[model samples]
Target: MHKKVLNRDRASFFVITLPALLLYSFFYIYSVVLGFYYSMTDWDGLSRKFNFVWLENYGKILKNKAFFNSVTVTFRYAILMVVFTIVIGVLLAVALNSVKRFKTFFKSVFFFPAMISSVAVALIWDQVFIRALPNLAPLFGVANIASPLGNKQLALYAVLFVNLWQSLAMPTVIFIAGMQSIPDELYESAVIDGASMFDQFRFVTLPYLVPTITVNAILTLKGGITSFDYAKALTGGGPARSTMLIGIKIYIDAFGDTPKFSIANTESVLLFLVIALLSIVQLTISSRSGVNKA
Candidate 1:
């Protein structure tokens, strides 16, 4: 009787999960398969006369200078964002963790940016970069500079600055949580051993925070690579594609005038593979470090 009841429960669980499984398979898995199929076609995104082109789109993308430039810009953006986010996040987390008064208030203040819409943040930064600096230029004895987004040389860095500011909060919170999880006894023991605060952090806090660090690093890396809204709203990958990223390039190819469906799909496939490979590498490094620390 117990065995029958167990089997019934298992059957019910499977039945309950069936709909969600079906939905995921249909929407996500099916789309990926279709996208792969489309990548080999010469579709113009909205036509029925599409036919398979067999690697032409892939060749075109690989040969396109603008596409290669976008890839380089995307790589640079992701690397810098990841480095700064991790460093500043760890610093802010340490500061917040060490603070005794109104810690929650500070955390809320720091995290408020993360809650704001990306478009809103971009618009606000756009105005600041365009107007606020010029208004203060005379006082600083400098000429009014156009918004960085309007300057080809500065646009990408401008976007990077805004992206970093918007992204810092989540990693900050994660690091703080990691630091808080470390037992006070560890620090106390370090102090008794005549260890300085920095030493304590280096030896005790960092080791304890490895798992959280890993999580935040991976999240930030992916977010930086996949960032599109800020690029779209702030610069629109403007100034002769100087600020173009892989995400924006993909968007333009897939949806802009003269849409190239096949090339867009190829770009999407390449992007997925790049991100997946990088993520795997990061996880491997993190896991190895975790084992060494253990």
Candidate 2:
């Protein structure tokens, strides 16, 4: 009777999960396999027939200077985004957590930007950079200041600023949660030991938030690499391609006037590999840190 019931329970579980498993296989597994196959071909994205020039697409991408430049831009932006997001997020979270009154209201206010779509944020910021800031410049005795989006030297930073504005909400929330998760006894012990506020934060709070930092780092890094809407809606890789991130480069290669779908797919595969590798490294480091802390 027990054996029969176990078999029946296993069957029921499979029946319930089969649909989701099938969807995953179709959407994720099958699409990835198909994309990998396409990456080795010379398909122009519209042709019914194509030759598989195995690994040639990968070689071409390696030699392509534009692709390299995009990768460089992406890494630079991603590193900056990760660093700034952690720092500002922790600071903002600490501030919000310290608030005795209106704490919930403050968090909601800060998170409001994230509720808006990226394209909408970019559009609104685009207007601010192009018209509002430029128009208001003369009031400060400055005349004819060009928008950062139109300036090659400052365009990337401008885009980073806008992206960071919207990206902070979730990280801040995570940091706040991390702070809250720390036991009151820890803070009480520190107080009894005569530790200053800064000392308590450094020893008690920061040590506890290492895992939170790791989580935010991975998220921000991925978001920075995959960012497309802001670049598209705000500058469109404008001025002189100063803000031509890898995602935008892949997109253009895939759907430009001369579409190179194979190359685009190759880039996508490489990007996936990069993200996976980085995430693994992050997790490994985090695990080591946790072990050490324990």
State which candidate has the highest TM-score.
2
Residue ranges of candidate 2 with Cα displaced over 4 Å: 291-294
Write model 1 residue lDDT over 74-190, tens digit each, in one string: 888888888888888999999998889998899898998889988899999988988797798788788875678888888888998998788799889889888878889988999
Candidate 2 lDDT by residue in tens digits, 38-108:
99999989889999999999998999998998998889989999999999999999999999998789989
Each prediction's whole-model lDDT (CA) = 0.87, 0.91
TM-score of each: 0.94, 0.96
- Scored against the true structure, residue 118 in model 2 reaches a CA lDDT of 90
lDDT score for candidate 1 against the true structure: 0.87
Error of 1 at 53 (Å): 2.2
Which consecutive 10 residues in model 2 have the weakest lDDT in total? 285-294
